[model samples]
Target: MEQLTFSSAQEILGFLDSALGRDLLLVPVWMRNLAYRLACLQEPDNTALLRRAASDLQFVGPDWNDTAHQLLRSAEALEAARRDGGLGH
Candidate 1:
């Protein structure tokens, strides 16, 4: 199956929110990272950081037929997030 591209965190959030709103048990990567970071500060364990990194490190951008296009979109998000200081580990 082909993957889809998302432009912004807002786009990702919107897609996931819509896709998962019908399912209450769904946990988005962003929310999970927020929780993981909070947990790490309280507990400060290796496991917490590992969990957070594993969840937050991956990119979920659009999936174009051209892998380069897909990767570029993902890179754009990462770069934007990095510049805006939106990316947190």
Candidate 2:
């Protein structure tokens, strides 16, 4: 598999949108989860993307429980940051 690189949320969302438009099952679950994870990292304050990433990771199976938990934790931190006015947007 090629290394996935995403610099911005728009780029990540565009890639995800395109992948979702096609037969997503054709893509491996790991790849899909990785894309979502990267997107979440790019926009950590985006609760929707973070939750989506966590959900996708959970779907990858029991082996990913730790990672999924971490994503959820990150989402919680992001929420706290938002409430604290630490995030600009």
Candidate 3:
């Protein structure tokens, strides 16, 4: 497994998007896990996590920026997992 270095929700989302492009079903499980992890790391409604996630993406590979945008498109899907009492929250 590749080691992930996400410090915010955006980075997680970006990572998720990249994973999804490879294989939707397979990436969701891990992406959701990372999302939950990122959410947990957040300061409870504070946008610091989002900001951090954005910053983290900059530290990643160039493709991560595009990945982040793709993930942004699937916010509802990600949130749905959280609403269903998934891992991130």
Best by TM-score: 2
Colliding pairs, model 3: 36-88
- lDDT per residue, candidate 2, 1-89, as tens digits? 34466356667777767877786576688678767767776777788788878887787689888988887898889788888999876
Model 3 over residues 1-89: C-alpha lDDT tens digits? 23454356555556666876687566544445456445536543433444444444544446567645444444545566777976465
Encode model 1's per-residue lDDT on 13-83: one tens digit a residue.
45445765786346664554454334344433333243333434343233312433433455556667767
Each candidate's lDDT (Cα)?
A: 0.44, 0.76, 0.52
- Candidate 3 residues lying further than 4 Å off, grouped into runs, are 1-6, 28-31, 43-89
Model 3, residue 76: distance off in Å is 13
The order of the candidates by TM-score, greatest first, is 2, 3, 1
Strongest candidate by lDDT: 2
Per-model TM-score on C-alpha atoms: 0.28, 0.71, 0.33
**Regions of model 1 farther than 4 Å from truth:** 1-25, 48-52, 59-89
Clashing pairs in 2: none
What TM-score does candidate 1 reach? 0.28
All candidates in order of lDDT, best leading: 2, 3, 1
Please report how far candidate 2 places residue 40 from its true position, in Å: 2.9
